[model samples]
Target: MSANGGDSKVAVLVDCDNATPEILEFALRVVPQFGRVVLRRGYGNHTTLANRWQEALVRLAFTPCLQYQYAAGKNTSDIALALDAMEALFDERADTFCLVTSDSDFAYLCRKLRERGATVHIVGEAKSPDALRNASDQFFEWVPPTVKATSEQIPALIQKAEGSKKDDAKAVAKHRPLFVVEAVKLLAAETVEGKVQLGPLGTYLRRTYPSFSPKIYGHSGLMAMLNTYDRLTVEQVVKGSWLVSLSEASGK
Candidate 1:
């Protein structure tokens, strides 16, 4: 997350034709890693398909954009999704984007967004096209559907684990903790032009490094851990979310 404490603004666009409704539920669980889903829109010809998604879509507050197929073999849903994505980008409504689909058509859209300096996350099934996966800043494959944990569970787990240390103090004492430094380096390497969303950095850091929790180091959150280091700088964008950057002088 950004050194400054704020949320990143994100737009979530769902391609219903190529994505399952259950995937939407899975994808939403991890979206907070980027920012808030300030704008949510989905495109598909709902008439041809019958599923529980119709009710779920409204319950989830998704703005469904109807795209009826023009002919027997034509695919209009992809076109609709592309148009909406371009409109969102041109309007500057979101700083990051989440594309929830497995179709390769969105591979071009992902590249276009990153070219324009927007972070893109792709969430789809494991068999998602490689081109789309490559275009995303990070990609996640959906697992079997499960009930989501309550918000309180995360903090409670952190609190309970504070007293435990997997490594001995002597082992840790020989080296200064470099979680923040390593996280920044990893993000820079993965991002274009040494920039990445603060949200994805946190996800990557946790997944790649063991014993890298901010709470374990006496900090309540990722931003707090980043603040402890002078080499990192954080900025607050529009929605009180943070964007983190490495200071040029620090040479990190």
Candidate 2:
């Protein structure tokens, strides 16, 4: 998704065979950030849809695209999803697409979508491969609700597990990539106060790195991840807005 916002008709196609019912919530939450979602569909066989996804499909208002396997082991759902996406593209129903799956098989689909001038965003789990992540314009890692912790709770959990603040900081820093800090510095340089708003900083990071995710560093969200860093400070400038800047120890 582009940093500059506009009305881009979005088609959200979920591979129910590859993605769980829990991830649908996260996919829906983030899809609106790109544009108004025009099409929401889930593709799977009869057993797949009936088992755990029937309730989720109805609750989320996703039209089910049922594809029964003619062969014993062959996955016909993927082919059906790919075909529907291409049809939506040719029909001019969507300019942006969200492929909700972690499977690398969709990398080719992403490439084709991009070639035809469609913006593709892949919303998948942390286990999503580099090939799939790289193929899309943006990749949003879907952290399960059970594992998601608030910014306030993450530190307490870290403290209880590590038993030392120093060790906790080290562990977090080791997992966090250098590009996150570099991105902060880059965005901060443009501001007169040498500080970047948390919202825009997150947008900048996502735009700059498609695979970048707070979940990769064991944090639930951007604020939680940023709060773990010792070299940066996050302070609320108003009720809901936060300002993120380098700490004095960073010497930047």
Candidate 3:
């Protein structure tokens, strides 16, 4: 990180099979929160992938790791990513790691990074499994920059309400508030009071979901967005200071 604490040296690794060029771009944008992105690399079976990925990675100055499938029904891309992560860890090439993929296969990789005391940030589609998202220090959902996000783009994966568990897709489509609830629940668990402070809450949300904004949800600001949800309780203890608690119905 920079002397003032606004910079960090980061290495961004991508699972090309499960990610798109745009998603990688979004993740790159968020990496600066931790520090400068010093290294960029992507792993995939480049032979079969669309040229756009190869073109994008190169254009962005990322090392394109080509992992060929040795045999039929084999996934070599994940293995390449895993090995590279371990190499980067031992080599001390980067202080922080940003993994861009929605696949649960990388869950163990994220866990290992955390175990080694490295900051692990995951950028993936919201349908990512509960275990996968919770494994990282933070998980970012890739919300498209323009146009409203459709249910297909972000399915409410974890923290489904009682009645909604049976069909999470419908829940995400019917009630978009669960997205915020899920992230809040994750942060709330680490706090002793089970309440997330306003400042840290916004910071975490922004750091995790770079595209997050109240206006995207039709609200003026973070507080306004929190107020619109019945599952959350937003309280102000001082001017420009507040606390957010997940309501009982939130199933925190």
lDDT of each: 0.70, 0.84, 0.74
User: Which portions of model 2 show Cα errors greater than 4 Å?
Assistant: 1-4, 148-176, 179-208, 213-252
Task: Give the candidate order by descending lDDT.
Answer: 2, 3, 1
In model 1, the runs with Cα more than 4 Å from the true position are: 1-7, 48-52, 146-252
For candidate 2, lDDT tens digit of each residue in 1-252?
Answer: 556446788999999999999989878878887888899999999999999899999999999989999999999999999999999999999989999999999999999999999999998886789899889988877766567443212233343454565555555653666777888888999999999999899888876677666754656689988887888899998899999998899989
TM-score of each: 0.58, 0.66, 0.64
| Residue-level lDDT tens digits of model 3 in 173-230 | 3334567887778788888988888889888876566445554454446876788788
Query: Cα miss at 126, model 2 (Å)?
Result: 1.9
Candidate 1 to native Cα RMSD, angstroms: 9.9
Question: Per-residue lDDT tens digits of candidate 1, residues 1-252?
Answer: 543214567888988888778778767876776777788887888662346457657878898878777899788988888877878878888868889988988999988888888878888775686687777876766644353322212222223343553332222232225666767776777767676567887887754542245554545568766776777777777686777777787785
Among all windows of 10 consecutive residues in model 2, the one with the lowest summed lDDT is 150-159
Model 1 — TM-score against the truth?
0.58
Candidate 3 worst ten-residue window by lDDT: 151-160
The pairs that clash in candidate 1 are 3-234, 4-234, 6-240, 6-241, 6-242, 7-240, 7-241
| Model 2 TM | 0.66
lDDT of 3: 0.74
